[model samples]
Target: MKSGDMFEAEPGSANRQEINPLLKLALELGPLMIFFFANARGERIAAAFPFLQDLGGPLFLATAAFMVATAIALAVSWVMTRKLPIMPLVSGAVVLVFGGLTLWLQDETFIKVKPTIVNGLFAAILLGGLLFGRSLLAYVFDSAFRLTAEGWKKLTLAWGVFFVFLAILNEIIWRNFSTDFWVAFKVWGIMPITFIFTLAMVPIITRHNLGDDSPQDP
Candidate 1:
């Protein structure tokens, strides 16, 4: 249940190192806040630092900052824990690729659809893991909490389906809305929705809890 056990404690182990929950939350959300801020003020930023103009428009500049922020977040996580968290690693990879394409092509669409791609990939991975009897969510959630095999399976299924729904929702939002609106939604809307969804899972977690109760990494 303690933050210190986040990375160090295994299900059966007692020893743990201090890892601040606030720091962990900051690392996860910092890059996203950077992205939102950059996009909101991208024009002024480009004007102040003309070199950023080379990256293209506001969206392109924002994409560049996002890529850098994601890299820094990942690096900090590695330095702190000596191992990359699986979900963030995967999300960061998608950010770099899609961010690269957005900058390179001077197109905002790539950046907009990055969420769709990432969520869709997660959906596929979780579902595929089920087909293979792997329960891969265990790898991501294991250090945070322990669950029965049935609990893991049900949780994985729920998350996989939720991811698919998010993917579809993202596609709908981006394809039908303005760039600014989409940016706002990505930063303000999606994050809160995901948080609420995670909170909603507490009862499910409690139903199949296995006693370990370290905080989950989002």
Candidate 2:
């Protein structure tokens, strides 16, 4: 495994079989959906089944459910694809850690701050790699694109700074807003922003595309 060799699995190998992008997106999103739904239905479900309520506040129960759902979703993804996504794996670890703190300390702050911490970690790793003259985003994205090295480098830097911005935004939201508001924002707010930002990258991706290997230009 060379430092710059980002492809963990060779194409067409058992581990590198092309994953349906939608399914991949679902895996990424399933847990957050569970969290949001669980929170929305928390009081009702807790009333119907009181034991679930004792888990703590609606957010706490939701955090616990989110953790369980994240684990289940990851397991199913492994069962279906037999390959783990590196970035999500990193996020999952943070979920467990911060989620545990939320439960153990019986406070919502840890869970509320989890995204900021994880995003910061991502920003640090990606930017630090750039400073070292390496582009690590190539690993997680290799399954999706085949950009020229320069393209990978530039996109990597862009994502790195973008992640830092997201971290700052998370901090601002959680610090100033209510727990309910923050959770709502975490689930609903980030997705569209991320989608729009990703779309904004299309031009850059087009410019650096590997021609026939690139996504069909619109």
Candidate 3:
């Protein structure tokens, strides 16, 4: 029922080093915060820097900073663990690609749609893994709790569907709203929604936990 036992059961997890929960969260959220900040203060930032004035506008400036921050986060993770976390790595790749296009073409549309692409990709990956009988969510949550096989399947299914919903929500918001509103929502709205959804899963996790005191169905 321990984390070690869960890792041993998962392929390629035996040697995985557990990242500190707070550090992991900071690494993930840090780049996002920078993105939001850069967007909100893009004009002021560009005025101060003078050199960044050529980047066009707030969204483009945010995209540039986001790409840089994501690379730094990945590099820090690699240096500390000698292995890149799968989900972050995938998201970082998308950021670099779409961010690059946004900058190169001077089009904010690419950057605006980046979340839809990333979320849709995650949803596809999770759902596809389920089709192949793999509960890949275990990779992300293994350090948090140990769950029964059925528990993992259910949790993974829930997350996969949630990702799909996020992708759609992102498309709706970005397409119908102003750029500033979208930037604020991406930072303020999405993270809180995800945090609430994670909290809501406590009952499911408690029911299927492999702890000694957890109840089992008859």
Q: What lDDT score belongs to each candidate, Candidate 1 first?
A: 0.82, 0.81, 0.87
Q: Name the regions of candidate 1 deviating beyond 4 angstroms.
A: 1-19, 213-218
Best by TM-score: 3
Better of 2 and 3 by lDDT: 3
TM-score (C-alpha, index-matched) for candidate 1: 0.85
| RMSD (Å) of each candidate, 1 decimal | 5.3, 4.1, 4.9
Extract clashing residue pairs from model 2: none
lDDT of 2 by residue, 25-67 (tens): 8888999998998888888878888988778878888999999
- Quote each prediction's TM-score: 0.85, 0.88, 0.91
Best by lDDT: 3
Candidate 2 lDDT score at position 158: 89
Q: Ranking under lDDT, best-scoring first?
A: 3, 1, 2
- 33: Cα error in model 1, Å: 1.1
Sorted on TM-score, highest at the top, how do the candidates line up? 3, 2, 1
Candidate 3 error regions (>4 Å): 1-12, 212-218
